[model samples]
Target: MKQNLWINGESVETENYRPLLNPYTGGQIAEVAEAAKEDVIRAIDSAAEAARGMAEMDAHKRADILRKVADYIQEDREECARLIAEESSKPLKAARAEVDRTVMTYTFASEEARRIQGDTIPMDAAPGGEGRIAYTVKEPLGVIAAITPFNFPMNLVAHKVGPAIAAGNTVVLKPASQTPLSAYKIASYFHRAGLPAGALNVVTGSGKNVGDALIADDRVKKVTFTGSPAVGKYIRENAGLKRVTLELGSNSALIVDEGTDLSKVMPRIVTGAFSNQGQVCISIQRIYVYETIAEDFVSQFVEEAGRLKVGDPLDEETDVAAMISAEDVERAQSWISDAVGNGAELVLGGESEQQVLKPTVLLNAKPTDKISCEEIFAPVVHINTFMDFDEAITEVNESQFGLQAGVYTNDLQKAFRAASNLHVGGVMINDIPTFRVDHMPYGGVKQSGTGREGIKYAVEEMTELKLVSFKLD
Candidate 1:
């Protein structure tokens, strides 16, 4: 199979193509077009030229286009899920869920298009503004450059592109190199839905070649990216006053209070840690349990983690699949070994077979250990016990990244305290930090990156606010 770039509502074949391999089976899936810096510039030019047309489009027309894309996605749901699983190694079931989320994201963008209005200002509040009438209006930010990650390629792309289109902004999308096919598929859907010729353009290549070009181009007005903190920081530094929204790294932690029922929360904890091979930005990497129930919870977690079937992502029954690359597996193994060397006990499953690093667990790891402090994007989690509730909150806040944290507590006071003092973007009570819907304001403070995603908030981010005032005679 061949996957080409989508520019100006057309397929663009390049002389140089990179073969995309299935991480699970190590089989060739497709040869994806390798976008050069020149190609990326062309894509940007296309989007820049289309911005005026998109801005002139009626909001109802934009809403109808978004809805049609969602309808088409629903019609071909299984094929889209297969493409995501094949390209990114996400399990089929989880890939299907991602497709559902993408559909909902577009659906929400459609709804938000009609509701994108600003508020009227009370000009009379000021001493000299007695006879003035003022209001504000939302306007599109022209061209948006969307850089998505490989973990949830389809849904994450929808999160950026859907809202941008809803706000009547043209987009220049650079999907993750490993998962460009999904982006092209989505672009095709938009074209079929009657989007204007140059409204959406996709260029695929390395971040250095394609992403840097997109970020440097002044024609691209806003850049929204989802990836590591290092790259996010680089974009922020070089974005040159252009609006940027970054959803970066996270070592998300969860606390299990003393009174919580282990049986009820055990499955969620397991899923939160090992889902997508722990590639998810919000996947729980650390767990702090109350001292009284630490041992019981750890034992239950280990048993449950061991039961997860590690195999091909395409397999219907497979619970875990291959990591994106062998290097990722080796890096995770080294971290596990280093943690064990640093007095952390490797309780269960610390070995790697092929590309799949079996879900590993550590007990009593110090906060200073790499697995505990760093954003280890792998299927490994460290468990620690806390004597006091306040100590657990403090421990969870010790890291530089603060995307989201979860606390499972029966006591209302503890839950409220956790919600207030967690020092993260969001605090989940009685649920995992990995819990997120398509419409919630999602982003982090500190090193987790600035600005929020989720459709409505993203629409606001992709637009500019202009004030309008008139003097009454």
Candidate 2:
């Protein structure tokens, strides 16, 4: 297949192209147009010109277009999932789930398009002079720049682009270069849904070229990014007063307290830590088990993780697939080796074959260890024993990332305490940190990210509030 940049409602091919490779097979899947700095500028300018047209669209009409796009996605769900799996090396089942989630995201955006409302202030009750009335209206922030990651390409892109369109903002999307096929597919669906021309542009290229140009451009009003902390920090520093929403990296933690049922939590633990080869931002990286159940948890967890089928991502039964590239697999393997060298015990798989790395389990990893302190972004997790619940919470909070954390316990008070005490953005009770629905106010605190993403919350971020006040003549 040959894909080109989607600009101004047209598929435009450049003289330069990059071969899209399938990480699982190490084969060329397609060729995508390599967008240069000039292409990025053109996309931004097209979006700027279309911004007023998008803003003038009626809310119900916008909702209809989004709903139609969701329908188009559902109609071609299997093909879209296949494209995602082929491009991103995500397993077929996970890719299907991502497509389903993308559908839900657009559906939620459609519903939220009509619900974007602001509050009415009681001017008389606020010590203001009598016979005055005031109300606020939410208005779109012109053009949006959405930079998405490779993992969950469909859903993450939907998280940004769906909300931007719903909020009446034209978009210039810069999808991850490794997996631009899904983004191109999504843009096609938007076009088929009768969205106005030039409303959404997809530019595929390197971050330094396309991404930086988009961020630096004044025409792009709001920037929503999901990537590493270093790049997120760069965007934050250089975005120059533009409304920015960053969903950065995380080394998420999960705590298993005493008296919890291992049967109920073990499956979630495996799925959370190993799904998509653990490339998710909120993938469980650190597990803190109470000493009472530490041995049993580790044994059973390792057993389950070992049972995961690792092979081609196209296979329906494959539980784990290759990383985005061979380089990522090498880095992940090095982290595992480094942790073991630092006195950590490797109780399970720590091997890599080409782009595929085995789901690894480590015990007694020090707090300073690379796997413990940093976002591994691989199928590797470390388990440490904690005697006290508060200590576990403290240990989980010791990192710079404060994204999402999980606690498994039946004790209501302990659950509430963990919920309050954990320094993360969200605490999942009796569930994994990877559990995220489409419509929640999902974001992190501190370096993890800024602002929230869920359909409604993102619409709020993509808009500005204008107050209208009236006084009696």
Candidate 3:
């Protein structure tokens, strides 16, 4: 298979190409066009030039285009899922879900396109505004640069590109080199959906080459990135005056409060921890169980985790597949070993075959261990017991990440307390932190990230507010 760069609404070949390998098999699935800095600059220029047409386009027309994109994705749902599984190592089931979410993301963006509006200001409330009227309107921010990660390649790209287009902004997107096929396919869908030429471009290559070029260019107006904290921080530092929305790393934690029915939520908990081999930004990495139920929770959790089928991503029964690379597997192994050496007990799994690290669970890991404190980004979760709810909240808040936290408590006061006091962007009352729909305001605080990503919220970010006032002559 060959995947070329999509620039100016056409497939373009490059002199240099990179082999894209399947994470599970390490087989070359496709040869992707490698974008040089020059290619990236071209994409930037195309998007900048296209911005005027996109901004002049009517809102309903933009909405219709998005709806058509959603329909096209729906028509190619299976192929999209297959590409995602082959490229990113997401299990077929999860890949299908991601594709579904991508469809909904575009759908939501379409709905938001028609709904974009600003509030009328009460000009008469001012002392000298007796015969004056004022209101605000949202206008496009011209060209936007989107940098996406390997995990959930289709849906995360949808989260960025859908809203950017809905807000009438042209996009220059640089997808992760490991998973550029999904982005290319999505761009093709947009082209078929009647999106104007150059409204969206996909450049595939090293981040330093493509991403830096996009960030440094003066034509790009906003940069929305989803990836590691280190790279996100670098983009924040170097993006200059361009608006930035970063969705970065997290070690999301879930609390099992006392008297909770463990049977009902155990399945969700396991899925949250092990899904996508724990590559998701909000995958559960830490669990704070109440002391009264810690023993039962650990035992039941281990038993259920053992049932997860770990093998080929294409297998329908496969629940856990390979991580993105062998290096990530090695890093996870080292972190597990460090935690075990620091007095953490490896209860269920601490092994790997190739890039697939078995679902791992740790008990009584120290708060300072890398596995406990950092975003492990592996199928390894550390379990800690807390006697008091406040203690659990404190432990969850101790980390530098403030993405999302979950609490499985039936008590109203406790649930509200967690909602109010947990220093995270979102607090789930009875569900795991990994629960996210396509249209909710989703982003984080602290080291997790900045800005929001739900379609409506992202449109707000991609657009500029202009005040329109009128005075009686």
Q: Scored by CA lDDT, what does every candidate get?
A: 0.93, 0.92, 0.93
Q: TM-score for all predictions?
A: 0.99, 0.99, 0.99
- Candidate 3, residues 1-473: lDDT per residue as tens digits? 77888999988888899788899998999888988898898888889889999999999999999999999999999999999999999999999999999999999999999999999999889799888888999999999999999998999999999999999999999888888889998999999989999999999988889988988988888999999999999999999999999999799999999989999899999999999999999999999999989999999999999999999999999999999999999999999999999999999888899689999999999999999889999999999999999989999999999999999998899999899999999999999999999888999999999999999999999999999999976
- Regions of model 2 farther than 4 Å from truth: none
lDDT of 1 by residue, 1-473 (tens): 98888888889987789889988888999998898998888888889889999999999999999999999999999999999999999999999999999999999999999899999999999899999999999999999999999999999999999999999999999999888889999999999999998899999988989989988888888999999989999999999989999989899999999989999899999999999999998999999999999989988999999999998899998888999999899988998888899899999888877698899999988888889989999999999999899999999999999999999999999999999999999999999999999999999999999999999999989999999999998
Q: Of models 1 and 2, which has the larger lDDT?
A: 1
lDDT of 1 at 445: 93
> Lowest summed lDDT over 10 consecutive residues: which window, candidate 3?
347-356
